[model samples]
Target: MAFTLPFFSAKTLLTTTTTITQFPENPKTLILEQCKTIKDLNQIHAHVIKTGLLVNPTIAENLLESSAILLPGSMDYALAIFRSIDEPNPAAYNILIRGFTLKQSPREAVLLFKEMRENSVEPDKYTFPCILKACSRLQALKEGEEIHAQIVKFGFGTHGFVENTLIHMYANCGKVEVARRVFDDMSKRGVITWNSMFAGYTKSGNWDEVVKLFHKMQESGVVFDEVTMICVLTACGRLGDLELGEWINEYIDMNGLKGNLNLITSLVDMYAKCGRLDTARRLFDEMPRRDVVAWSAMISGCSQSGQCREALALFHEMQKVKVDPNEITMVSVLSACAVLGALETGKWVHFFIKKKKMKLTVTLGTALMDFYAKCGSIENSLEVFEQMPLKNVLSWTVLIQGLASNGEGRKALEFFSLMRGKNIEPNDVTFIGVLSACSHTGLVDDGRNFFVSMTIEFGIEPRIEHYGCMVDILGRAGMIEEAYQFIKNMPIKPNAIIWRTLLASCRVHKNIEIAEESLQHLVRLEPTHSGDYILLSNTYASLGRWEDALRVRSQMKEKGIKKTPGCSLIELDGVIHEFFAEDNSHPHLKEIYNATENMMKRIKSAGYVPNTAEARLDAEEDDKEASVSHHSEKLAIAFGLIRTSPGITIRISKNLRVCTDCHTATKMISKVFNREIVVRDRNRFHHFKEGSCSCNDFW
Candidate 1:
């Protein structure tokens, strides 16, 4: 089977059976020409064999290369032809090497290179570049380095193609420093070299270095292209540097390189991330073409900027345009639903995910879990947790927090135990949830133990949120003095939230002395926040010190502070109904008022008494009673009672902590109607059932 004839001689190779005028005179040239199909190649192959050209190396190599590259499913035939050559050259070995690499079989190329070296077929410049490409694809750093040494030994290191390939190999292998060293050693740098290095830095998240390298390239007067612009915009997005990003945009305009899809996408992302949504959207709308990435950037930007409703609306619009949402789009959409507490929309999204057969990755699964938890769907949250095949620290923490938020503190603690049994180490957020569970359940001792274990056992230093939770635990349990003392003895400086926690607790427990102390610190820390002043003023009013209450009110008026009006949300028939204090502007305004009056009468007869102390101090008794009766949450609840079907649980979300009168009214309504009511206020969830609350009337 071995042939050792001259490589490409035309003298003794002709033995044609057909007419000689039909094909090229040179057999080598004819083999290199394009064939329409495998059938055409087989005919030409038959011609070559009839011409006695099987002994010529060039004809054989060309046939093998054409079959390996152009003809699909013919690499086996190419390999057979390659094996038949008695002493194959490097060019022959390179044909199969490149074929395997192109077919995504990098290991095969490495193996063939080994065979070629053993056969003493010295590699040329072409041989080095092809094999190095295979090494880059495989990320075989050791093999690539071996090739590098051989390149130097063969004196082919000076070749531009070889040098560029080397740079790419090191960069792709994550040895950016080594790649940089190679770049520094190169005497002739081109666009490819700079792009390779910039891409490496970008992959490693070294955006500063990318900017610095780009500056150096500019100073060196090297020509910049679209790829360079993309890398620069990415750096701007990461750094939130709007100034430089704009400058780059100007440069693009000046250079007349507009309408580049990738460059436009980068600019959109950069402006959006830099907190310039208007500019980003303007640029996005002006783009001649838009893709999924452009739409996702806008949606994600809206979600991050606290425009969750806008984000969801845009997602709907994106679908109408027939652009399918990717996983990231769904994640952002789910987050918007969580913020809006739009359970129905979230369910639709979940169904869409299933309908599209989208795989629930850990991140997407975690986002869904968070959405359900915040939307008051603990069952769904737990279901996602259990169904997820993989769990990270965030997954475990979200589930724990969800349980705590739903007033299932005991269950949250038990889940934390299970998490530990699985050897999943708790992070700071995990312990925050653990301590919060104890706080909600009034397990003071458990809270203390977990707080200590956070630092001693897990080495997670107590963050301000953790300390605030501990203060809330003690303060809510009528230990206001202890909470104040705890703040004074803190290792780090206590924040305004800690003092605010103590002040709010003081208001509930009527600890006027410690309330004053906490308010002093709170006012100094946050002078403009109206909540602390309102809390202290309420403390004064609760003690019947009208003058002191008036004094606090005067100070607030002088400082131009106003209390945040309470707002409540109730979902009815998949639509959220919002109500503010004394709000009577609903479309069914008369019916809502009539329902509130009827519910008030029924609850009053059922042993519910109006707690008028929450009303304004300057108001008369009648006015106080009227204000307490028409509070935002009561209005929302009355609307729910009128709109929802019988025996349905009512869920409401509040902007501020529920007032005492509204809390009592909801508990009575829950008992009289034999319905369970769940209210998620600013602080914690209150589950009212049968004249009882999950918080044990503590929050």
Candidate 2:
């Protein structure tokens, strides 16, 4: 094989190839072929400079055409070559203008057009559309009108591309009326022109016009694009029209349009907000791939529907799939924690925030503080507040509320003062927190000053909540008549809470007449709540009005309104034990009952007398004693004593306010059992020790 072939000499091969030419005769075609990419254009420019043909007139014109049309941003190199010519033709200016417009440099395009006009370069039909596109992107309405005049001057106004871009310019610049006028005046229109008008209406949020235009396009037999479908779906979402949204979904499915994540996410959110969570979940499940947005929508829907546990479960499941959580996800999860009082879980979220280095924006920080506060971690709530990089009104309000609810009223009031000192002007909610603190701590004078300052200093008009706090403060301080007078003079009508506060104070002071007046107003506002009727009955019983008490109970029965049974729960060793009135459900019920009986004996011997009158039973003395013995807090304490050793604090949370008989019994039990008992009811906390309550029998 090596000896089979003969090789030609280099001199003979060069002489043979000298007769052939490799390039085109027209340099224009050669230039166009050479200017394929930016690097190729540069190489051609170098070759042109080396050939000494750069100054040649015909070659320069051809170079301008090749560079401008072949490469984007080649206009600059082409313009340099064109300007080097002493007298460039109109075609050169047209090439530069079109290239500038194509590069989205609209301002420069307009400037080039001006330079061309000053140089007396006549524009052709192609020149008008390019310049009009530049005007549209720049939103240069006045300049666009000038271009329109030029178009009419050039007799190209009726041209399709020219007229379409004019419409786009006017519409995009918020001159839709002008756009419509142009469209109406047009002798002929294309699908691009109609689409421009439709998109203009959509951008203006004119949904009705968008729909009308869409129908008009359909009547004209114009085809729609994916952009149109997405836009209509957005409008439907804004209207919360489930019917329309479903129609659009069905249309998309029937058309077999490839479903994208954005469309699916929007549909899910719209359905969820319209109270169609099941449908939302169905749509979400049908998605081929679940993004973070899809997961967040489902989690938020669950939270909004009061399914906090389910929302939390979904959040954990999201983590298992390694879908990174964003601000929206964290906010929804934190809200779920707030509703569930999930302290440990909320803390873990906080830790995650730190590990991820997420910015604690005002809203996110407020949500975190709210979660901690609601979960009964006021200290952690305060820490979150202090560490916040930015503080809004809500941040300050949540911290103050947390402190007030945790019985740190003094600290709450102090923060309110600090807020004022910092000139963080107080709003109505700020006053609510401060007034609530005053109510909790019995600072009547401070509350009155803040209430007055609300209108006088801050110009914040007082609402019903503010009035309620004022009434509560006075009522809790044993000024029942004063609270009644305040309610009478309130500018806004007193609500159930205002009247209820008065009735509660009346019960405490044994004032039957005031209780009757408050009860009358309460029943008129909220007649369905059984607690209101029960409170009124208890007030009557405390006043020895057995007939009125019996009448109230009978009316409740006739209305099919049953009083909520009082139940208390205690947490011990990470387990919660619940007890109800007269409950014997525990396995060691016998032992618990015996232990409670013995404790009661010791309590009575220590001077604790049962106040059955507060029960409003209207029974014989023996029956009243039995009724007092079967209270839920007594049962909880009995179970606590049987289950735990002495000297440990017993914490119980009751659904309803503790009755006077149970309150007295708890104080005595604390002393007899040598334990500190903490009872949290709907209103506030009661700390009992050594046969006395921390409230000094005032609460």
Candidate 3:
């Protein structure tokens, strides 16, 4: 080395020089490549400061740009570095504004743009799109228009991206016509521009316009994607145009989109809701993957169609498939159970929830409680309700309804008071439940107070349900005239239920004139329901107006309508047996008939006297007694006593209100057999014990 070998020394020197200048050749590019995301950018920034390169203006601007794009809140950090420069360019300002738009703080973006303008940082074509996107999100049409003028003044309106954003802004802000004008002015429009306009029309419920625009886009050869198909299907679904929906179904099939879960769900819901359940079921079965939503849709369809058994079976099948049941699924299943009076099945679901530790969401708990209550198992319902750690308005409402249905009307009132004491604000549903309790218990004053408090204290306007409950409460308490006046004073027009409540009361109190008036209102409101006509006929017969009753019956015949036959069910030893009035279809019919006849004779011996006139029968006294002997409740009760021990309680559920004869017969039978009888009818529960009813003859 000391001898200075010239070739070897020259080689060593060249290597040293190459290493020293390699980083400087592309220092800015190296810095950007290092800073990709927020964390990486911060680390690189630290490296830049440590390496004494922070003072380089080019390096500093690159850092600002990287941070603005990579990190959401890094705009401020970028701006701090940007301001340190001697003079920043429009690129720096544009980066900051775009960052703000990405953060959804569109107002801040526009403000920063203005600040940039004041600082003499002129915007380029890139700046307008970011600003216009912000305007579209904010729906600030006026601000967007001002920006549009500025874009034209700057000669950037011809930029396709800038023009498309303006179209979107106007379209999103409900200015579709203006958006169309801007789109027409565009020398060239992008696919995004067309999509924005299509979405706008769909959102505005302009289904026809949506279809026309979709066709136009297709004609222009724009390829349809998942998003476009979804929009079109949603519009068709909302319009309830089965024909259009069918067309879309065929389109999806032709396109080989059967794997799309969202599309399948939408089609299933559309078909089911449009009264095409068979088609919906076919689609649902064809799906390879069935989610909880698909199963819930099918169950809801069955429930609405009164196919309770099918709904319940589907719910069970859903569980067997291990599809996790959500709140909606629980609601549908519970509604099905309620319809079928499937108390045991409902109980199993309640147990399943606890076994699985499913979160007791408010809706799920309310639905479960409602199912148990309707199925005549209020005790179990209360157990589930009390175990809930959280209670909302619906929880209280369901419990109140359960208590009322179980003839624990006083307990229902107490629960309402407790709910108020706990400072849990009551909603319209809670008030409905409370009023229902009062009506069942004949608490006229309590019901009135709740009705007044609904408007005066809670600011909840009374709906038709509340008005109907009030009428029921007053009518049950024999205030027939007041109930009629209350219906007259309802702010909203009285619906069938409201007028029917008054008519029912008139029949109870023997107010024939009031009953007639209420009947007229009912017939006008619900002309298609044969039950309403039959009820009016019964009311006329109650007052010995046989001709008037016959006239109502004639109208029913002319309308091709018939009343639903009264039926009752009794559950014994985990088996349910059903009986219908005037029906002799049971295998044990002869025994049931003989027992019912003997029981009637014994009940008459106990001072019952076969009060068939109370049933409004248009027959001889002897014939009336014979006819009333075969009433459903009478058959159910006689069968229960024959089957069960003398001291055991007999429980029966009737599909209709307990007729006057049945009520008297139940009381008499309870005393004669020395056993308690619980009869849950359409309206309320009647506990017959020791020749007395819980309703105190008030119902």
Candidate 4:
């Protein structure tokens, strides 16, 4: 438990030893009752002079400062009055500077400092803090240094008031080193001094240093404030230090700092980011009131943790409470909607943005674009990108990645070129999108050259994801040997993704030897992961090696591993409906089954065969066919086709790769039913139209 600021602000540091002269039934009470406007203030100024109240320099300077405080816009009138005084004191200068700086007129305040020095009015201990704050606000580091020298020259070097502001100025101007020197040299340190240095490090994005400084503060036994905790909480969140975050929560309670809204919000944010959603929500619900930022933190955390339904529910509760959401909140909502394929709800949010006339910030626009693309509305994604007035590297990455995910691989590469042509340097993420484009479209040469150019042309050292793309590129192109060699030769060690990529390619290309080898490596790397086993088993099943497939399945049983159940989601009227393989829980089970049965009959007539070879069950052909017929995606697609109007494309989100039988059936179903079917599965998107797929049977 430590001391607490309860609240913190730069204006708190702008305090002065000088106090405003109190009037006794004078200008404020007697004559200035109608002084509502600047004009009335001018009249009052003339009257005060006519009454001979401004007798000497002392009274004149006081009046001048008072008028400035009263009419903040009447800086010109205050200056005129100040000039009329024979000699304005340092208190007069400090008072004016503090007023202007706190009112968001830092430039004018600094200019007054220059004028004060020109008139030979040397600044005192009080003057340095106010002027230094002005320089901090303006980020005028050179001027701050000049003021630092003046502080030393005026014998105010050792004053805590002056040194604290000096640290604040240096920190605000990104001079953390200089600020730390000031902090270290201070013989007498208090909570404000420590808070000032911590604030500077937080502002400069030295998060690790923030945590380190807090430990030092604890050792020093300086009672810290809410501001100090905020900095430490932020660092803990970024570093995912849940243990420290829990300790912070306990410390807050032990110290009786729970009533502070900012401190509570910071705790909520930290707990949520560290994956303690239940704890975060408890803290959030216990609050008497919530702001947009607190709501945003919770919603975004839900989205990031794959709790899309919880996220959307929180957003709905937020709306009912009338706490208006800002851009950050909307972005998180859009992300949740995207994952759930809640297209209608996402559109409503988009409309809300337009209705509020909120500018399309880069992050918000990118989120919208990603939502649309994931919902299978690629055109809407493109429109959002085009309408964005400002774009950064993140913006371009989202667009390119969206295009790639929507199966517009060629278009993604084209935009990558456009991005490079515009002098927007491609970061590591941008290259992942670009390389993925080449992999999906079977652009092997392009993928290879781009992989090399990542380091050569862009100077972006290849990451694991980039290397995985190359493995996928070669594997998908039926170059199994080269893909395996690539893995072996990787400068960085191959992760599970690379081996899995090569395994998948071996399955597709029927390279059984390499597939088994890849599975062996995966067994060592991820012995408990069910994915590699499933893929290798499927590889065997596809090639009529059921004994090998059954053996793998037995190994899974021995390890107490079960394949993840396939689940698919379809959105209708802003509501997402989920279906599992052979699901029987839906209220519309009879109708959905009937619809699925009829759709299968029609696709069978259109020459869709039951590819039971893809089935993992070691059962009779009929049982395998029965199981494959009602895979989660088919059930979800059936529901979509029955509820939606004819000719409207149906979209599905699946938690696993689309089985071979499902993919072939969907292609025929699209042609026979005269509808497009868009299914985004675990790996990529497949757009089924006219008995052909966007992947061109490669996937």
Model number with the top lDDT: 4
Clashes of each: 1, 0, 0, 0
Score candidate 1 by TM-score against the native. Answer: 0.78
Q: What TM value does model 4 have?
A: 0.84
TM-score to native of every candidate shown: 0.78, 0.61, 0.63, 0.84
- Model 2 residue runs over 4 Å out of place are 1-258, 270-275, 544-548, 565-681, 684-699
Ranking by lDDT: 4, 1, 3, 2
Instruction: Please give the RMSD of candidate 2 to the true structure.
Output: 11.1
* Candidate 1 wrong stretches, greater than 4 Å: 1-217, 410-428, 441-462, 473-482, 539-551, 571-576, 616-620
Per-residue error for 400 in candidate 3, Å, reads 2.3
User: Which lDDT tens digits does candidate 2 get at residues 623-663?
Assistant: 77766787888888888787788787676767788887888
Weakest lDDT window of 10 consecutive positions for candidate 3: 1-10
Q: Please write out the lDDT profile of model 4 over residues 31-55, one tens digit for every residue.
A: 2233345554554456457657766
lDDT for predicted candidate 1 compared with the true structure: 0.85
In Å, residue 551's CA in model 3 sits off its true spot by 6.8
lDDT of each: 0.85, 0.78, 0.78, 0.85
Poorly placed runs, candidate 4 (over 4 Å): 1-36, 45-182, 203-206, 456-459, 541-560, 616-619
Question: What lDDT is obtained when candidate 3 is compared to the true structure?
Answer: 0.78
Please tell me which model should have the higher lDDT, number 1 or number 3: 1
* Model 4 clashing residue pairs (backbone): none
